[model samples]
Target: MGEAIIFKLHLVLGTTIFLLFPFTRLVHIFSGVAAPVKYILRRGYQIVRKRT
Candidate 1:
C-alpha cells in the first residue's frame, strides 16, 4: 500500500512538471528581445555621459 501511494504521487508530480515545462519557455520567447536592446542603449549612454 505504501509503495502504491508513492508510485501514484510520483506519477502525478512528474506529469505536472512535464506539462508546465514548455509554457515556461514562453517567458523567454516574449521577453528575450528587450534585454539586448537595453544593454546596447545603456552602453551607448555611458560612453556619451562619461565625457562630462
Candidate 2:
C-alpha cells in the first residue's frame, strides 16, 4: 500500500459521506448528536452570564 492509495481511499470515503449527508439517516444522526451539545452549552452560558 502506498500513500497515494491511502489518500484516494480517504477522498472517496469523505465524498461518500458528504453525498449521503442530506439524503439519508446520516442527516438525522449528525443533527441528533449535535443538538444537545448546543442546548447544554447555551443553558450553561445563560446561567453563568446572569450572576448578579
Candidate 3:
C-alpha cells in the first residue's frame, strides 16, 4: 500500500513537469543544446551581396 502512494506521487510530479516544460525557462536548455548541432548540419554558407 505504501509503495502505491509513492508511485502516485511520482506520476503527479512527472505530469506537472511535462505540462509546464514548454512555458518555463527549462525549454532554453534544449534549444541551447540543439542549436549547435543544427548549425553544423545546415547546408551552405549564407550569401552576402555588396552594395554597388
Candidate 4:
C-alpha cells in the first residue's frame, strides 16, 4: 500500500540522517566543547609544573 511505502521511505530517510550526523556540524556542536576541555587540561598542567 501507499502507506507502507511512505513508512519505508521515512525509515530510510531517518536512518540516512542518523548515519550522516557525525559528519555534520550538528555533531561539531558537541565536539566543539572538547576544545575548552583541552585548554583547561593544558592550563592545569602548566600550573602544576609552575608550582613545582
Candidate 5:
C-alpha cells in the first residue's frame, strides 16, 4: 500500500513537471538544442575595421 502511494505521487509530480517544463526556464533546453542548427545556417561573419 505504501509503495503504491509513493508510485502515484511520483507519477503526479513527473506529469506536473512535464506540463510546466515549456513555461519555465527549462524551455531553454530547446534553444540549446537548436543553437547548433542555427549557427550552421547563419549568414557570413561580420567584417571589422580598425580605427585610426
Candidate 6:
C-alpha cells in the first residue's frame, strides 16, 4: 500500500516484460523498427504480402 511497494512492483513487472518481449511470439515488438524502416525502404505495403 506504500509508494515504495508500488515502485518495487512496477520495477519487477517491467523488468520481466522487457526480458521476455524479444524471445516470445509477440514480435509486434518490432513494429517500432518497421515504421522507420518502411519510410526508408518504401516497404509499408509489403506487410500484408509478407504475412500471408
lDDT of each: 0.67, 0.68, 0.78, 0.69, 0.77, 0.71
| Runs in model 3 lying further than 4 Å from the true structure | 1-3, 34-52
RMSD of each: 9.2, 10.2, 8.8, 9.6, 7.7, 7.4
Q: Estimate each model's TM-score.
A: 0.41, 0.44, 0.52, 0.47, 0.50, 0.46
* 1-52: candidate 5 lDDT, tens digit per residue: 2568889999999999999887875454466778767766778778999999
Candidate 3 lDDT by residue in tens digits, 6-52: 89999999999999989974564566768767756767778999999
lDDT of 2 by residue, 1-52 (tens): 4578889999999999898778863354456667756655653334456667
Candidate 3 structure, TM-score to reference? 0.52
Rank the candidate models, highest TM-score first.
3, 5, 4, 6, 2, 1
Give per-residue lDDT, candidate 4, residue 51.
Answer: 50
Candidate 1, which ten residues in sequence have the lowest lDDT sum? 39-48
Error of 3 at 38 (Å): 17
Which should have the higher lDDT, number 1 or number 6?
6
Task: Indicate which candidate wins on TM-score.
Answer: 3
Q: How does model 4 score by TM-score?
A: 0.47
What is the clash count of model 5? Answer: 0
The count of residue-pair clashes in candidate 2 stands at 0
Q: Of the pair 4 and 6, which is ahead by lDDT?
A: 6
TM-score of model 6 relative to the true fold?
0.46
Q: What does the lDDT read for residue 10 in candidate 2?
A: 94
